[model samples]
Target chain A: MQLDVSHISIQYQDNVVVDDVSFQLAPASLAAIVGPNGAGKSSLLKGILGIHPLKKGNVYFNGQTLSSVRPHIAYVPQRESVDWDFPATVLDVVLMGRYPHLNWWKRYRSIDFNIARKSLEQVNLIDLADRQIAQLSGGQQQRVFLARALAQEASIYFMDEPFAGVDAATEKNIVSVLKELQAGGKSIMVVHHDLQTIRSYFSSILLLNKKVIAFGPTDEVFTPERIQQTYQRESLLL
Target chain B: MVESLWADANARTVIVCTLLLNSAAALIGCFTYLQKKSLTGDAVSHSILPGIAIAFLFSGVKDLWVILPGAFLTGGLSLLSIEYILRHSKLKQDTAIALVLSVFFAVGVVLLSYIQHHGNGNQSGLDSFLLGKAAALLSADIPLYFSVAFVVVFSVLLFYRPFMLISFDRSFALSIGIAAHRWQQVMVVLSVLAIVIGIQAVGVVLMSAMLITPAVAARYWSHRLPVVLLLAVLFNMIASVMGIIISYKYPSMPTGPWIVVCISSIAVLSFFIGNAKGILRRSSLTVQK
Candidate 1:
């Protein structure tokens, strides 16, 4: 499946935050959207997921609009945006990802539970399935969200700041999981702020600063000139 | 006093009705408390006062069928106005709630006083609604309480998943194409129904306590919502029974205040001694450290 976000703009009240940005990603690729603070990186990700109404333009997933293929797409919201003290177990949280697929009145069957457990196993948190969400460490919480997106069984996953505050070990684990997903033919787009890891972690990069500064293969678009332009900091490369 | 209370046959009906009413209040209260909208209950309860007064003034009777719809509409309107203020104005939710609550309640008080001074003989007992007189609960009112209780319990059970989803993470729920706004409106409407049913027994002033205290007590006992709701209902039933007995024994005591007192005691106990996350256990752990 191909993911295309073309000429999308976003505004909050009178202020236009994300101006006319466009990008595309082929299946089985790991891509990053990066820029400095207030660069609209998160806004662009939300726009593509249809979280907020786009001021202009559209997002196409495999030749259809996002609403038509919503089940085939998944979103992992920022860790900070959720309530940590929410009264739910790890398994309960992961099971929610399957709600879209099941009938509204249907209870979770053995199949759904098994899939949820398998997703937990992939994140190495199967033993903590019954634990309360607040009992987990920060990294473990991020893994729980990853497990939820995995249980979604979506072909395209859009993650917002999945690695913002995680430890180094969790970061490595997430990178490996992304690699595995790509190997399995899933397209992954992440809103990442870490400039140091872009070269090593992603094949494609979208440099954004209220607009699309550059977007293409990492080798071509991750140039210092582009980073400088996006961040408005000439010394960023040094 | 206790023996006389036990001997009265009508005591059974009063106890049962109050029990059902408290259970319904506590069940829906769990979500409102969890959502940090505890004050919403207070606001809605106070705002329903004018609705009840208007319903009585217009209909010249205090029938449940007449008074309840009027109260539900005004309560729902108060909720909507609070929301509107939150969205379109600079005032915070708390300020909006406080303003609407006091203003609407004032209007209700004026109407109630006017009806008492000038209206028909049917308006004589309307003051019982101010603090609630469960001892006055009639056999005719029992069926209404039962039906409302059934609706509250049934709706909570049937829409449990969607309600939980929307309450926990609204944006995630919206992402999945769940009509969160619509579901929220349904929950609000249900909340209005709960408030209307409870006001006849718990009254307006103390009703918010009935909606929040049991849920708070239950939260101390469990980290899961289903457990919390179950525990809340159990607590509610126990408190309601105790309140009915106490108020029956002391003829001057109002049932609503007694129930509030009993439930507050239970909440205090749970806060200190509950097994899951109690202050005693927390302090003990700190002492060991």
Candidate 2:
């Protein structure tokens, strides 16, 4: 599957966040969005994901408009977001991933349960399946969210800051999961901030700073000047 | 003659109306509880009194048809205002929630007092709604409340998954094809319906507690959504039945305070003696550790 983003521009309350950025990705490719705090890395990703409406642009997932590619997409929201103290167990949270596929009046069936269990095992969270969400550690919370995303079983995954605030061990586990998904012919677009790991982790990079600063293979875009330009544009993301 | 008064048609009508309102309260309570929009319930309930007063000016004979829309419109507007304040301001959600709540409630109180002192005739059955009198419910009120409850619950059942998704993460839900605004409107509509259905049997001041208590109590027993809803419905039914029975024993006693006392008692019980997520259980386990 090949995805193309063309002339995508986005603004929030009259201020432009992403300025005419564009890029392309092929099947099984791993791409990282790199940018300064306010450079619109997250905004650009959200735009592609269709959460943030574009000021002007279009995204094509396998030659189809992204707005029309709803069923094939999965999303992992930021960890800093959401209240973990919500009264739900790990299994309950994971089961929510199956919601898009099910009818509104229908509860989760045996098939949904099986899929959720498998996803939990994949994330090594089968042991904590019955645990309340608040009881999980930061790393464990990330893994739980991973299990939920995995349960969605979409061909394309959009993750926002998956590695943020995680311990080294959880980071390795998550990377391994991402690699496994990539090997299975699923594409992933991750909004990432750590400059040191960009080269090693991603095959493609879209460096941003309220604009498409650069877009190419990681080795080409992860240069010192691009990194400086992305972050130096602003101090805070919000 | 005294025993015959107990079996009168008016008493039967009151009982039926109370049942319908309680059921509606439980249904809306489930959604508000899950979305953590329970506090918004309080804000809307308190804000609708002035709207009810305005609605009464046009309504020659005070009835559900007149007051229900007034309550719904005012309650829905209250939520919109709160949301607007939160979205447009630097104030955090909790702070904005508090501000909107107090301002709207204060306005409602002023309007209600004005109507109470100046209005002519005993037709001002309005003051009784301030602290619901189940005894005042008439035969005409039944179908209106039951229909509203049915609609609210049916809508909830019909859009359960989509609303659930949007409630969890609006950004991600938007990305995945769920229209955030549409689902939000559904929630607001359902919440307004719940509040309106409640105003007759449970006073607007205490209606939010009616919507939130069962869900809060249910959380102690269940770790899943469906289970939580079922448990909440069960607890709400029990509280309603207990309050009705208490009010039955004391003829002059208002049902609103009794119901609130029942809900509060249940909440207290859940806080202490709850089986799984209760304070007593957590404390005992901690001591063991």
Candidate 3:
């Protein structure tokens, strides 16, 4: 399902964090949102997911308001932001992704477990499924979250800073799983930080700085000039 | 010797009530434990005595029926004030907690002093409300304890996901349309209700300890929410019973203080022995790993 964003703005108190921004995503598009720290990248993702109250605008998923699309989208929050040291097994954390799917008093069936296992396998974490979250390495924790999202089986996936601090193997695994999901016709929106990866990893971009500075194909919009400006680098050309 | 000679039926009654009250305290402790707001119980418990005194002055009955509700009202209001101070004001949560706790408890102390100095028509029972007199527990109190516990357990069962979601990851919960305010209100209101029901047995002085210590001890055993609640309840029941029994054996003892001491001991032990997060447990895991 396609997403249409109208002229939405967000302000925390009087500080205008997200200025009027609008965009549309075709079905099954892979969009990467990137910017420097304190650029309101997370806030924009939150706005689209209907988390924060928009200062002004509407977000429609599949021609319906995002609120109306319950249980159809999944979010994989950043690893650093979560308390992974919380006493829960990897499998237990993954099962939480199924909460929206179950009715009251209904537990996960064998099929649900199978889906979780498959997701874990996709992230190559099936063997460590029963291991406690605290015991995992940095990259393993990221994939654990991905495994949880895969268990959701949602149409649109919104991930915030999914690759901040991870080893090369874990990133490759995530990219490969994401590619598999795209092949299966699902849209993925990612909040990213690294500039070098935009060309190879993502299809589109949402360059942000409390506003949509640029949006379009990764190749067209991720010019060195845009990267330099977003990163606030010292200009060199005379 | 005279008091010891006279103590018989009243002693046994106190023992039973102590067990029951501690169990209830621990049950509520589980919720506060998961939220990591354990000290809140102590703050609320100390602050409720002045509320009780105020409620009595207004209603002129000093009955639990009226005073209990009033104490909860004051405590609940205190929580709202704390949250407001936290959100809009520049104060940190710990600072706000310290502010509310000291201010309300000091008010209680002043009100209590007035009652004592003026000889306000037999404030004997009121003293027990401060330090707690486990022997003073009546048959009438059991049902109240049971009812509050039942409601707490039932609410947790019904809204388990919402509460867990909010407690686990608030941003994720909000993203999913969980409106955390509604359920959080329910938790805080229930915590107030638990504090009200607890004041009689644990006493306004040590009631907060009962709410926190059980959860601390339980964390040694499990992480799953249901298991955490169960372990907390078990630890509290044990401490409450032992506290009452010891106080019985040694007269001139306050049951609330003893119960808190016992629960705190358990907390210390749990910290050392906890399997997942305990220092010893982690050490053991590391050695084995």
For the candidates in turn, chain A alone yields TM-scores of 0.96, 0.94, 0.94
- Candidate 1 lDDT over B48-97, as tens digits, reads 99999999988898988888888988898898889898989999888999
TM-score of each: 0.94, 0.91, 0.92
Better of 1 and 3 by lDDT: 1
How accurately is candidate 1 docked according to DockQ?
0.44
User: Each prediction's Cα lDDT score?
Assistant: 0.85, 0.79, 0.78
- Compute the interface RMSD for candidate 3: 3.2
Interface RMSD of each: 4.5, 4.2, 3.2
Off by over 4 Å in 1: A233-238, B1-9, B283-289
Q: What's the CA error at residue A22 for candidate 2, in Å?
A: 1.1
Q: Is candidate 1 or candidate 2 better by lDDT?
A: 1
Q: Which ten residues in a row have the lowest lDDT in candidate 1 chain A?
A: A229-238
**Which residue pairs in candidate 1 collide?**
none
lDDT of 3 by residue, A1-238 (tens): 6878888898888888888889998887888998877778888888888777899998999899876886888888878876765657888878877777787467678888888888889898888888877778889999988988888889999999889898899999999888887788899999987777878899999887777778999889988878777666223332
Predicted candidate 3 versus true structure: per-residue lDDT over B1-289, tens digit per residue: 3255236666656555555556656665666766788777777887788888888767765566778877987787678778888988899889999999888888888987787776557566777788886766656666666666678656766777677777767777776667887888887777777777777767887788888878877777775667777788778877877777777678688778888888899889989887756788776553101
TM-score of 2: 0.91
Candidate 2's residue-wise lDDT over B9-99, tens digit each?
7766666566666766776687787778888888888888767877876674568888888877778788888889877888887887788
Error of 2 at B150 (Å): 1.6
The stretch of ten residues in a row with the least summed lDDT in candidate 1 chain B is B280-289
Better of 2 and 3 by DockQ: 2
How far is A25's C-alpha from truth in model 3 (Å)? 1.1
